[model samples]
Target: MSTQPPSAPVAEPPPAGWEEARSRVYAVGLAAALPSTPRPLAEADGHTLAEPLTTRTDLPAFPTSSVDGWAVRGEQPWRVVGRVLAGSTPAPLTSDGTTVEIATGAMVPEGTTAIVRIEHSARDPEGLVTGVPRPRPEWRLPGEEARAGEELVASGTPVDPALIGLAASCGQDTLQVRRPPRAALLVFGDELLTSGPPADGRVRDSLGPSVPSWLRRYGCQVRAADVVGPVADTLPAHVAALRSALGTADLVCTTGGTMHGPVDHLHPALEALGADHVVNTVAVRPGFPMLLARVTSDDGRVRFVAGLPGNPQSAVVALVSLVAPLLAGLQGRQLPVLPQVTLAEPVPGRGDYTHLALVRLDRATGTAYPVRHVGSAMLRGLAGADGFAVIPPGTSGSVGDRVRVVPLPLLPGERTW
Candidate 1:
């Protein structure tokens, strides 16, 4: 059997600013939906809804007690009729002066006109209940919060834990949701390590560990087994890895090999695969060579590729610049709104390139200060910083300059500050 020859590489010049590159990427329009399926509510967290979700039943389901006291029909000093728990039904109150001892969230018996709080009510030795009922009834009427058949969530909504819980409460055992976009990682340098510390011209593979995690935050289902390759320093290896990934994933992310250095084989591989450049590169400091491409499979599936830089922090910026938006578009989500931040001090510019400086924002003030150790290859500044302070091309950011900032992924137990 004869092997096919590789295609000649295309050398395209990128526009000299970030906005131009971003516009180019946006215009190419690589957005496409992944498959939709019915997932159990137990497993629907983070998935996007493929259709509108309606409530199967009214919220509260029945007339429920809002206070742990008495469910009384008329005035104070009523004879206790029965007890009502959260799950069990209680007998009806026959007399006007009868009451039921009701727990919070318990279904109130028929003829319950008011709920008296335990603190406001008293139980006499004769088993009679007495209290002043607050002007308003403390009972939660059925459908008080939401009505049956009402729209609970719109199509394209993300199924968060709260949404899943809401669905479960509305008798939804399963949700029809869009599948998480599948992705494959190709960390291209030959010198990267899977394990130990950097030594003798080789460094630990940060992208392998970091990219997959970031992709998850961006709504991609990147399995552990698929985070393969810093492919060999050959054009063929690059081509092979990309081809294999495209077969399975809707998005393929490659770290490093973005530049035209002697060892950089990404452009050639992309050429060989007949991939069309969506955004060749952005004019941005530290990660100027970031690129996005679209590859059409023979089966008609269009897969996206995000080419990230070799440097650790640069790679992260590139991911934020392109892949995040790509994933958002694919999942039918809106582009995240960057928060406005005040710069604590001056951040110098880089000619026409937009500067994305990793900055630690004041926890109390929302003021961003450029962190130390922000070189492209360094991760120290990124680890400590809250977000990137975007300074525009050709101008240095002055103290208290207001600019948009994109936040890092929230930690496991961390909420937005």
Candidate 2:
């Protein structure tokens, strides 16, 4: 059976609301360490560009046929002299009463006035063309979508598949994007097993497989080399893991050991390392023991460490509170904007702390309903949840009350719908 260890000397309870706790970390400016670098376009998806995308060639470099049709000079009832398919050279039509058969995307024949749709044209026994052309030109003129040297997309744009396609259309093979912030994980718990199911009073380590997935979703690059293990519950082991992770990681995440339990060594270990706290404990339910700190590497590079609680659900909540915004800023991505939704039923908040409830969303109606089995140690609730619904300190929200919902990990500029 699990036991509650002696309480850590409670620091004065954090300012009484979730915003105050999050604002404290936001004020520290944690984004300076991540840098920008030129990256190949193929591999740069999800990165924010550090420079504008300038076109190397005019969009539709040649006059392009928008429809498969006959390229006519002026009048119909003309002779079909040649045929032009996409990528094929077309015989120039220089005189009136002459036409050339053309396929979609084929370059327009020189001196051609417009395209007559194949459905609107007919060939007589003598190979004479007869049709009334559409009023508008059915060909895209060069530079219609973009001109060479034009700025197609501004700097700081997030690169998605569509943006990548845009860059490729503009003749770019590569782009400059902010380098992904590198993070390392250190899961701390002597009772956690690396493999197999929970048995004999030891549980499986969930953070190793789960937390890194979250980090990657938020645009962080978690290298496999830096993931240390379920270190033994000892100060020396904790300190050793901390120092080793600080050596190469911009951010090191330590799971468990934030409290004052006999086995909890993160607080004392961090103190021994002269680390400064960014957020010691937040005034939030289920994950209040979460901690963020700044520590300098032996080589003088500044690094960060976040201590997550032992409970599986609480640890993930802490991650959403601390790491999500921090990584967004560090990766040069915009802070995520929380979506507001109506509650499907009444939910109460903790008297001294804010409550976050995992919820399922009816996106079509913009309403949130609480999920079941949501204790700190339980992961079942989160597995079926869409996002967290914020219930502020000292207040309750009834059905139809508007509340802010923090979305699960999303790509930049992606809409919840």
Best candidate, TM-score-wise?
A: 1
The lDDT leader among the candidates is 1
- TM-scores, all candidates, are 0.89, 0.87
Give all candidates' CA lDDT scores.
0.84, 0.83
Instruction: Provide the clash count, candidate 1.
Output: 1
Estimate, for each residue in 65-124, the C-alpha lDDT of model 2 and write its tens digit. Answer: 999989998776888888899988777888998888899999998999878999998899
Which regions in candidate 1 have their CA more than 4 angstroms from the true location?
Answer: 1-11, 20-30, 88-94, 195-197, 411-414
Which tens-of-lDDT digit does each residue in 372-400 have in candidate 1? Answer: 99999999888898888888888888998
**Which stretches of model 2 miss by more than 4 angstroms?**
1-17, 20-30, 81-93, 146-154, 223-225, 298-300, 410-417
Residue pairs whose backbone atoms clash in candidate 1: 187-230
Question: In model 2, how many backbone clashes occur?
Answer: 0
